[model samples]
Target: MATMQSLAFSSPISSHRPHQQRSHTGLISSPWVICQSTHSSFNGQSLQLPQPRRVLLRGSSKLTGAITMMVKPVIQFIQGTDEQTVPDVRLTKSRDGTNGMAIFSFDEPSVFDSTGELGEITGFYMIDEEGVLSSVDVNAKFVNGKPARIEAKYIMRTPRDWDRFMRFMERYSDANGLQFVKK
Candidate 1:
């Protein structure tokens, strides 16, 4: 068995770099150039002059651009239970670690139940902040001649891919009581 000290020799993860570049900062440009021009009559008219040069458009700070990028995520939530039609669901995230989802559409409740039978089970899904799928499924279980199981699936996801999924889930949940369970 290797001791903790021996195992801690080195890890490639330490050298792992995502190569992230700041869009507004100098990271996006290599060797930025600052140009200046001095006006002179026969190179001897430096008696008096105002400010050297005026900056046209100021470069946005990396922080401001990051804040705006962080604010534009569109997320919605919903919950329901149905069985016949396919449940349309969407998953998304609000912030870095928070999560949410939406329902795209749902079927009528009438189609979910019979005169004396187990009702259909239905729900939706959402994408978490990491861009993984978290789903809510309702299953109506029938054993022999009786209904036995009604279950649901609470899914999970990452932060990156959440937004695209949530827009789809928003519709169905709007029609039914949104059964979103956050972890």
Candidate 2:
């Protein structure tokens, strides 16, 4: 079983740009700042940011450091009954970067160790600035596989709903023993 971990840190320079819209599918529209972290990680690899870049609200804002190198964001289960083959999952970020959609496949026999049309899992989540995750929706084909699907939707969010929706992802990640990598 592989253990999953979510890391969150405060940015030295947090500048918010208002009145801008992002061109992403799953992100919410709001005032967002470019997060330029000094130290970052992607899939357990250490990364460094180049410089502070102003993100345009009308398009997809790229995060510098470890995240820019990957083609897509993915969540992999490090420890689970299905640990033999880490489930292949994909993440779609929303325009504002606070919301996300997670997709899991049961179609690949070797990837999920399942045959036939076992269907797929789709999860929607909201992440606050405090790095808490709130489930907006979670759909699954099999009930026994709920944990895997739920965990895959985990990610960071803006602090828009921290008080009401505040829930630490680290606790959940630690409890489930899962690790996530942002590409």
Give the alpha carbon lDDT tens digit for every residue of 1-183 in model 1.
211110011112222212332222111221233323333221222223233332343467332211111111112122222133233233333454344333233223223344235333324333322232445554555668665433334432543333233332332233222444333
Q: Point out where model 2 deviates above 4 Å.
A: 1-38, 42-82, 107-183
lDDT of each: 0.31, 0.32
lDDT of 1 at 150: 38
Over 64-143, each residue of candidate 2 has an lDDT whose tens digit, in order, gives 33212111111222111122222334544554545444443322222244322443422333232233233434333445
| TM-scores, all models, native as reference | 0.23, 0.24
Best candidate, TM-score? 2
* TM-score, model 1 to reference: 0.23
Query: Least lDDT summed over 10 consecutive residues: which range in candidate 1?
Result: 2-11
Report the lDDT of model 2 for residue 88: 36
